[model samples]
Target chain A: MGRRVKVLLIGFGSVGRALAKVIALKRKIINSRYGILIDVVGVADSKGMALKAEGFDEYELLKLCEVPRSGVNLFKPYAHQGVDLNILYSNTQPDVHVELTPSEYTSGEPGLSNIMYAIDRGAHVVTANKAPLVLKYKEIVSRALSRGVRIKFRATVLGGTPFISTLTSMRSHDVERIEGILNATSNFILTEMHEKLVEFTDALKMAQALGIAEADPTLDIDGVDAAAKIVIISNILERPLKIEEINRESISRVSLRDIIDAVRQGYVIKSIASFDVRGGKASIRIAKIPRSELFAQINGVMNGVRIRSDATEVVFIGRGGGGIETAHSVLDDIVSLSFEDS
Target chain B: MLGRRLCVVKIGGSLLRDSKSYIESAQKIREVFVENGYKAIIVVSAAKGVTDKLVQVAKGSQEALRHIVEKYLEVAKELNSVKVIKRVNEELKRLEIVAGAINRSGVDLSLYDFLLSFGERISKILLVGALEATGVNALELHADELIVTNETFSDASIDYISTSANLEKLYSSIVDSPTIPVIEGFIGSTIDGRITTLGRGGSDYTATAIASLLNIDRVYLVTDVDGIMTADPDIVENAKLVRTMSYRESLEASLHGAKRINPKAFEPLEKFYSSKLIIGSWSKFGTEIVKEIPRELWGPKVIMNRASQDMSYMAIVGEGTSSVQFIRNVLEIIDRNGIEILGLQSYVHRPSLLVYVSSTYELKTLHLLHKELFEGV
Candidate 1:
């Protein structure tokens, strides 16, 4: 039998659900392969929370996924509705607190508070929300360190592609720069404009229609999403920078004519987010990279990050927007945390 | 189960475009049914452009496949519910498997229909999520589990007997529960368990079929447009909303490209029960399609226009328009004006007549028909 790790998931949104589903669907394989049996003891959403002292079974986890607002209904045998996170933590006493709340960059509330509270209570924290880290990375990390609790946020940047993890593992090598297409939505819209010869607005509409972009796409189109990722990356590289310091340029002004003209000139317009680690600078802008470049080849809702280090320039390309992939990354982080503790 | 007051609401794809609408829909459902002490069954289409993207995925567009998955994820994110988001991911995974099979094996209609079913399947989860977010206890009821059909794949006709039995059983199981059941409209499954779709605009058919089976009094078809209009509002600036019309009138209008209601949607209602069908948007009630129209309200309920590059016509739809006297009078007027009628079609059973003429004469024909059919009334 593998080691048992009890998890309490907050914010039952796409990423959270994806993690639950992944745990349910790949329970046996994950347990056998990683020697860890994850037990989700508590789940909470905006409306209510569900707690089980004995931890939830695979069937319970799946049933939780089918419920409407909260997993509270799934705990009908011992139903407690409208329970807050405080009650959940005290009752369930989870080993790891999984924070999947929506990013609130201004104050990082809910996620920030949730992370701090979990760490204060002596539980490891794994987060997919980037807002808290973007706003107060140092404070959170220092708090986690002081408390001797591991805080893993592998799904925060690049939709859980292990970009940060890879960067962290390469600590021995002095990386000169880090740059690539960080925002999948912006990259997808730019690709659509160039390939379909449509106006920027039309490209955005297509992206929105396809679910590649958010309803309020200002964060992505205006370079804020990528900038946030850059900020996180800068923090990871030990070159912490504020989002306000990044030179940002939105993709909104990249018109159809611009795309067509660029295409004719053997160049492709990519919404590139780059961090010059040595200079301690970050910027997100629409760059006309040559068609032959690897960055230009990365299209649609796929993210690519190129790491230029003293050893080599390595690129990681993967699906950048969907919840399943992100959830998988979160799970990976959870497993890695479990291994570290062991 | 028999005495429970229930109404089926079919929400169109256009309404699922934004997050506000989902909340608004939940609020509306709460107001119209939950608060009023009625059980509501919601039938939803994929968010706008989801089905198209799924179809493209079936055609082996990897981009479309990504889009389909992301669209549901995006909706799940907006709803911000973990259960729904997880369910959406599970459904998308199944859809991706089906898509992968289709891409490898070329085009198979059955597989394609199965692929398309994911749109409504995912939409149902999102809607239920939103409804629950709004404090409504909602459960997703997959139509395939309730509605049984033949193996016709894309446009399968419902096997009414089995479907009615399944629906009744399903209702009986959840009769005591307070939760609202949300269903995918355009998709179903065969008795043998193969996935199927009811074709385009089939969501309307799904609602009507369920209403007929349950013997519900009214089924609301909520769409982006107000309802069946006097004409396509783009062409006729003064086009008014059709407040009430007979099912036959609606059917006729639909056949002539009204597109407000699916032609097949009237079949189950016309045959089995006398359910009142209401079509409208969220803000206003638009049209009521009843089993019968009163004799006093029988003439020119709606004026529908159809135009092509070379040919065009104005269709006058009303119970009175099917009368011999009305058609004769219309022909006489056309003769008196020496207007060329390229083609004309009328049936005694259908309460509408199409007068096709040259494309140039479309507006003139509309004015002439309006003068004769609507001016005095």
Candidate 2:
């Protein structure tokens, strides 16, 4: 038998649900190719916790995805209400803990507590949640380092493509600056506002309808989501900055007249996240991009990040966000962590 | 935002014959709607004969994909929008891939439906380009993602509840937005995500459904003809336009095989919002269809000469054709003229009355009915 990796899923929202579907679909290929079989042994939602030490099969996992929001307790046979995390952890004994809770910036909520618990149990952690990392990057990473248990969160920054490994592995550490369209919601809104001459509110409504923006899009519109990504990047590059350090202009200030005026000047207003590492400053600005540039080409719900290093500059673009896209990134982190010298 | 008025418009295939035609239609939209300070949601059909071309490709026709790509790109190039050109090229490439994949896997009805969707998909993108070119800001909405339908691939039935919810989510805010969204007509996706078509002449259905579901009041269906005519202009020497009719009358006329309107287009209009439909060319929007008109305004709006399998029919379609007085008038005229009637069909519930006659008198019957009921000549 190949390496059997047991996973525990916490928080079953859009991303969590997408990750489950993706894992079920790609399990066969992953098992056959990498000689590793994934078994999701436990799932936790707001209402309750569901545990099956033997792991959920494909059909059950799919059925689990169909459950109504915060209705994990409704899942039969293995579901229970108000189950303690300690007992839940001991029951499943998961090899890898996957936390996909919503990112509540202030307290970092359930994701922060869940990640801490997983680290204490010496279980590897793979996260799609950015709040905890953006809020407590050094504390979390150093804790995982001391525990000798790996923590991978590539999904937080890269939607469905590789970026963190590439950024972290690059030599010659003399990095100058970084600019990216990191947040999908803001990018989609800006693209609509500038290209289609839509107002900021209407563009945001479009984003919400498209499922690119959550019901409460405060973090995205306020530029915290992009700043969070920058903070993660800064921490990775060993030049950490507080989340508050990034001065950001809310995209809600954008108007149809502003976009129309920008078009007249052969420019498009884009929400750009810039980190001047040399100057030790990070800011999210409503920057005007020339029509002929690569930045202007990144429209809709696509993310593009450009790394300006000492000798060269590199750009990485991928889908900004979707449960399935981020799930693929999450799966990669799991597979790579399984292959580590444990 | 509520200060801006909204209407839905469908640019028909007959009008979109060439690149210049697309630009002209865009200019008409700008002059009529945008300049008049009304925001519009435009539903566009494929260029004339493109669906027929797609139908041939669906039946294993070879090398036709390139021609389709060129046809769409022709308009894109004229509009001079790089963004539109790029989108059209990408969609065309996807079409080619879908076509190639179907060829490799062998063709099926579902895949055939998918192949057919490209015509409208490409048309919608080009229309957006054309609209933007005319200084009217517009965007393209993908119908396959938004319009929900049943799994019947070739002749799909729309799930109005799901489709309405989706449309309301994406398009409900259009009045607040500056740009008009141009969407593809005659195409939708199944609840399980298979592409589908809403049968032939279904573009009108797409337009009316969007209007009714979004609670928008007016729908303009721009065709080559001026409006709903009394008789086929080719068949009768002096046929006049039917200026106004009810939704029920329009649906009845269409069911009797009227040429201009689609029967399915009235379902949501009558069932949901009862939006008014304007069926005509851009310059003269002649035929106005409301959910209901005053009873006095209910009479024959169209007379058609139809035949199926050697049986000839002169269909006199109107709002009050089933009324006792109107039926008496029609019978008296037929009797006085000595017209040989094979059969007759009329129900109190229906708005149309059908009279079966010999093929020899089909055109004569159509003309006689048109003169008496419409022209009063």
The superposed Cα distance between candidate 1 and the true structure at residue B238, in angstroms, equals: 1.1
Please list the residue runs of candidate 2 whose C-alpha ends up more than 4 Å from where it truly belongs after superposition: A1-342, B1-4, B172-174
Candidate-wise lDDT, in order: 0.82, 0.83
| Count: clashes, candidate 1 | 1
Expressed as tens digits, the lDDT of each residue in B1-377 for candidate 1 is 36557888989998887657777878888887789888878999988898888877877899988877776787788887656676677678767666755664444566678788888888877788788788988876768667888888899898889999878755655666678888999988877456799988999999999999899988999888888888767866667788999998898888877877788899999889778998898777789999998898888877867775656777888897878888889999888878888988888877888789887777877877766666554
**Could you tell me how far off, in angstroms, the CA of residue B293 lies in candidate 1 after the best superposition?**
1.5
Q: Which ten residues in a row have the lowest lDDT in candidate 2 chain B?
A: B168-177
* Top-DockQ candidate index: 1
Candidate that would win on TM-score = 2
Candidate 1 — what's its lDDT? 0.82
lDDT of 2 by residue, A220-288 (tens): 999999999999999988899989889999999988898888889999888999999889899999988
Instruction: Give the Å shift of residue B258 in candidate 2.
Output: 1.3
